[model samples]
Target: MKTRFWLSHLRRVSPMIGLAMMVLAACAAPGREAPTTPPTPNPTLTVSGGGALQPSPVPPTAAFPAATPTLPPPPGGFGSPACENPYLPVRLGATWDYQLIHETTDTFTRSVIEVTADGFVDQDEFAAGAVRQGRWQCQDGNLIYLTPGPVAGSVFAGEMQTDVTLESNEGFYHPADLRPGQTWHQKTVFRGQSTLEGEIVVETRTEVNYACRAEDFETITVPAGTFDALRVTCEVHFTTSVAEGMTFEIEEQSTQWLARGVGMVKSVGQTEGAPPYTIELLSYRLP
Candidate 1:
């Protein structure tokens, strides 16, 4: 599942009756069939007055009150402000689970992975598709090396902790896309259990994948609910892209996120001229 936006221009919008009438009118008026060029697309864009955009008040690493149904972030005594990467904020000696969702145009997949960080030397990973449990070592905040296999008598391999150098505090959105040094306003607008809750973001990139994404919104009106979150009627915007060695770029677009506590939890994305896809989350576990 790739959460990438694929924008495509409609080669045809169905019926040609309206276009045919225009062609006939042109021919009757000036003995011409209108220049043979196809009509161009004129997107009606609406910019913000306060220079505000949807996904309002988003930080580089926006934090949220995710379900601790299984995904709990850090334990007591190690409590601190949200880090760029949420995973780092977890207790060093704690064991946790992280459910990741990858979405493409046609398919949406879910993966549940358990992580036990016992001060590094004995880091272990249990995943659904894995043939055996994987082992890792926390070599500081930079390198996460593999040391052992879950299955007995297996060889050790090395790789980054999470494929991506995802610092625990990093925001899912690219930090560079944001306006730097600009003092913008931010506040939690709603809070509750997201009827639509599951995976948020993952660090894998691939090509030839199905993708889904949200389309649009500005400010969402949150309703009442029994959610532990501080915000309500919250808005969630997600973007998906496959960076399989190819450079894919899409501009920042705003859309509505509808949720009770979390207003609208939309998964929207756009890439070049591909069809945008949406992949919903079912469940998740955090450290």
Candidate 2:
């Protein structure tokens, strides 16, 4: 009876649970999608002294003291003006600090280092002492994660050390050309291998499916400030298979608030049988 009850509950909440986990994982290391054809590299702009182009900083507006509750999908749907993606600041030297609350409270930071001839590089540091060095690029007005690898001397989770290599660039945000009710899909696969105490090797394959939509607009207040933001909802399905024939599946729902020029100010994720998790921007420095 207990197994039957849990199964029934999972059937109803799988999508939401999957999305919650996906949002957290993706934020840490955005994966790559499988593309049928190779895409041409976008033109790179050079800055003064023949350096990489830098993003211009945008000033923040007045803050709203009152926190607005989440609202239903907006009527008539809204699209970004000029089809510009605002979720990624993309400026060199820009940084954002976030406070994540899950089983425990932790802080994380993401900083943009170099805007290369092909893409940009970011350094991600987790409170648990792990760090990820990655690259990102813009294509079709969407921000994509190109390649992500762990830095040497960076601390890793658990007793295993793992590395992530991108097979293809995966879209992380599509604020440009996004309209209310517009749905998009993404799939990513990652392979992880770890060596145990002796010489035993364990391989794990992770696959994630995301179905996201531009749902509405809302006012969210964080430690940084309050702003009117675009709300995006996603349903995610995740599967992990181990070399030992053990497979785990997860489902969740996630919501992110992207403020213009500020990026992600807040995200809420929830899964069944577990407490909800949240990440909120504490502060940020642009350019």
Candidate 3:
């Protein structure tokens, strides 16, 4: 499934709603009236003494401890102090190259990701140099996407001009450890203006609900190499309200295969009403 639902919006949405949907990837079926109730505050956000936003410590869930002992990081490992999951390494100077293939289009794009001090940057050089950056913060061993706004790296990005202000965000991007059947969640709300061809088309409010679970281990091969990898699946739901009195609901599902120290090796994703696509690691480099 398309991890970012908005990529399909341009093809299916009306002119007025098209830009709005692309901003949040809410490119799916229309839904009921927008809700009037305000959203609850995120439990993961807390104010520190300096008034900076901090992620609250997530207490361990005893129900699902690591089925296997956590693997030790390599000397000067990529993930080191900030990110803990062995499947995803986060450290400066590390980089990964991937190829995203759209089956329906029979076309492919090249993506290059480089790790930075704070998080990482992803650039799709073949897709008009489209770029997406993410910020990561650790909370009690969990890695959180600290930035509060529309997630970057959507396939639909670069299609419209969007100005979004995030209202709230809470959730862990990755847990300290992964065990078969382990699960996690994230929630975000954002309001934005989407413009098309230099004309403001619609105002939008979007809420995203994301969840993931660890499935099993498998040996997968890509252009890079073959290795034992953990399979993780995620379900993403989007609820969006447009100023023109429209609400859209979208669902997307994605599966990722992560290697012990190399990170994500392959991914398969599908969005509602869209064809499936695959992404595979082409190469990688580490410091």
lDDT per model, in order? 0.23, 0.51, 0.57
Stretches of candidate 1 off by over 4 Å are: 1-79, 82-249, 252-265
Off by over 4 Å in 2: 1-84, 146-159, 167-175, 196-200, 271-274
For residues 1-287, could you state the per-residue lDDT of candidate 2 as single tens digits?
00000111111122222232233233334362222222232322224564423222221111222443434332221122222355666667879998878656778797887764445667767666645456555444555443321111111123333333333223343434445566676554554433333222344455666668877678899999997887888776666655444576766688888876777899888654456778899999875
Ranking by TM-score: 3, 2, 1
What stretches of model 3 exceed 4 Å from their correct place?
1-52, 55-67, 103-124, 146-159, 196-199
Q: The CA-based lDDT of model 3 is what?
A: 0.57
Candidate 1 achieves a global lDDT of 0.23
Query: Higher TM-score: candidate 1 or 3?
Result: 3
By TM-score, the best candidate is 3
lDDT of 1 by residue, 1-287 (tens): 00111112212110111122222233334443222222232222223574311232233332223322242442333222221222232233433232222221122222223333321222323243222222222212221222110111111211211121111111122111111121111111110010101311112221111111222223332222222221112122222222111122222222323322121233343322334333232332333
TM-score of 3: 0.71
- Candidate 3, residue 60: how far the Cα is off, in Å: 9.2
Query: Residue 151 deviation, candidate 2, in Å?
Result: 17
| Winner of 2 and 3 under TM-score | 3
Query: Cα lDDT for residue 267, model 3?
Result: 89
